[model samples]
Target: MRLDGTVALVTGASSGIGAAASVSLARQGAAVAVVARRRERLDELAARIRGDGGDVLVIEADITQEAQAVEAVERTASELGRIDTLVNNAGVMLLGPAAGAPMTEWQRMVEINVLGLLYCAHAALPYLLKAAGAGPRHVADMVNVSSVAGRVPRSGSSVYNLTKHGVGAFSEALRQEVGQKHVRISLVEPGAVETELAGHNRPEVLETIRARFGGIERMQPEDIADAITYIVTRPRHVAVNELLIRPTEQE
Candidate 1:
């Protein structure tokens, strides 16, 4: 579980699971490169990590753009030495009825949730491979943060579900492609977590969610972060392919 002399890059690091995972990795002795679109939040996170005597590099970029995603990976590897771990956690969830859903929302979801993850994975793959072939850890890790929606299809979440399901499919294919190389590709599907992920929902959608889960206890970002840490911290021979974490009450 010790990651000393290794570097980890985390996307969507401004808040929620990304932020928590960054802190967790840093605590485990990995030099963390936190990527996000929000500079203020990234700086704040960096300050906290630095205060704890952990190394961190803040790279502010919107991974939805291919060039920006590439740059984020390049900068991390160039400046922080090499990327031993990558956590693709940037995503957005805009829930609503599919009949007359706003095209803008659907496009945004695909761009951020799907395209962004792809861009980051594409840009970081080479570095991950190189790190796995050499270096202190000898094995690299890529953890894609997906959702239970990927596995469960429900009404009013057609496009969001599509993006998540796509993530699962992509992760499995990549795992097969890169497994023998010692570059692990893992997928984490979270049922429901307390984060700002639902903040983009429309009023009606928000109300619908509130009514449904008003009494159900939601998991926290650290819960998912812990799962991610566990996957990445295993021995080189250990590969945790897929982890589905749902709250006990989240049937």
Candidate 2:
């Protein structure tokens, strides 16, 4: 599992899984472009990658905006040379009861979790296809980070589940569409990880989350990072299409 001479673009990279995945991929010898809305965090991440003797590019863009997402892909292709892997990890988890939930929260989730992921994938597909054909590895990878909620529907998380379920559907369909092109599309569904995702929810929702998972130890960002790194660094002929990871105690 080596990525020598390849380039990867990771979105939602200011922190959490995106940040960890960026560092992990860089260590494996890929020039990584870290994309997020926050510039300072990206700068910090870039310095760490450089200090460790890895090539990295910092791309500050709000992926929910279609134009910015397209520009990010173009800049990476022009600057980093070629994109061999794309990790669509930027997302939000705004959970609450469906009946009284704010429409704004639902809109925000759709904008980033669904539309934003779509924007990046659309812009990167051409490059990924080309990279699979001509790059050192002869294969390109795209990993979409979803949640277990994508698989199981529950009360109070109606819209959040809807967005993540959409991710799963799109990934499988695109995987079949691009399999012949050698562009690997994978979906990673994490059960529970300690990240800023939970912090975005309302206080009442937070209480419910805590009460439910209070006894279970949550996984960390690096856990998912390792899974992502595993996917992209596989032998070109081996494609790990789907991975569902969870803490041993999670149910």
Candidate 3:
């Protein structure tokens, strides 16, 4: 379960789950590249990791942009030498009834949640394969942060659900294609974690959803981070493919 000398790149790393995961990976001795659109937040996260004597790089870029995504991976590899793990954690959730939902929000969701992950994966695949073959760990890994909405489409979250479902499907196909190469791909599906994901919802919808979760405790970002750490820290021969985490009282 040791990740010493490994280098991991985590997108959406400004705060919440991505931030927590970045710190967790650093704590495990992996040099981490923290990426997000918020340069300030990324800088702060990098500073924190460095304060703890961990190796980190702050890369501020909008991953939805293909060029930026490619550059991010390139920069990480250039500074760190290789990428042993990649966490596609950048995503947007625009939840609402599909019939009358704003088209712009849907477009944004698709672009960030689906296409953004694709761009990062495409750009990082070659490096991942190289690291898998030559790095100390000898096994590279990819973790896609999906949602339980991907598995069960709720009534009011058509677009958000679609994007997550797409992530699951993509992750599955990629896992099959890359398994023989010893590059492990895994999906982490979280149910109702307390994060900024719901911040993108309309005011009315956000109020309603908050009221609903107010009664039942939601999972924290650290919980999901812990799950991610567990998956990536496993032995070279062990691949934990899919992990579904929800608060005990979520249902």
Candidate 4:
């Protein structure tokens, strides 16, 4: 479970699951590159990791842009050496009725949740593959943070469902393509985590969500981070392809 000489890049790392994953990986001896659009938040996160004697790099980039994503990956590889792990965790969930839903919501979800993940993964694949072939670990990991909605489509979550489902499909296909190269690709689907993920929803949608999940307990960001760490820490020959973690009371 040690990653003493490894470097891990985590997107959407300002807060929630991504932030927790970055810290957890660093604590396990990996140098972490935290990517997010909010520079202030990233700086704070970097300070926290550094306070704990962990190496960290704060990368402020809008991953929805292909060129920025490429630059971020390249910069990380140049500054930190090589990327042994990549966590494509930047995503947005704007849940509401499909009918009469604002086009902005759908477009934003697709751009950030789907396209952003694709951009980062595409940019980091070469470095990850090259690292996987080297010694010390001989395996690299790419973990995509999806959601339970990906596996189960429900009303008021049509577009959100579509994006997460796409993540699942892409992860599986890429896993097959890179498995023989020892580049492990995994998908982690979480159900009802307590994070800022719901802050982007409209007032009406927030009310609906509150009504639906009022009494159900939600998992913390660290819980999902734990799942991600487990997947990436497995032995080189062992690959945990998919993990679905739900709160005890979620179902």
Steric collisions counted per model: 0, 0, 0, 0
Task: List the global CA lDDT of all models.
Answer: 0.95, 0.95, 0.93, 0.95
- RMSD of model 2, in Å? 0.8
Stretches of candidate 2 exceeding 4 Å from the true structure: none
lDDT of 3: 0.93
lDDT of 4 by residue, 40-91 (tens): 9999999999999999999999999999888989989999999999999999
Per-residue lDDT of model 1, residues 105-130, tens digit only? 99999999999999999999999999
Cα error, candidate 2, residue 59 (Å): 0.9
The C-alpha stretches of model 4 lying farther than 4 A from their native spots are none
Candidate 2 TM-score versus the reference: 0.98
lDDT by residue for model 2 (1-251), tens: 69999999999999999999999999999999999999999999999999999999999999999999999999999998999999999999999888878999999999999999999999999999999999698999999999998999988889999999999999999999998889999999998998888888889999999998889999999999999999998887888888999999998
> Against the true structure, what is each candidate's TM-score?
0.99, 0.98, 0.98, 0.99
Report RMSD for candidate 4: 0.6
Looking at model 4, the pairs that clash are none
Model 3 TM-score on a 0 to 1 scale: 0.98
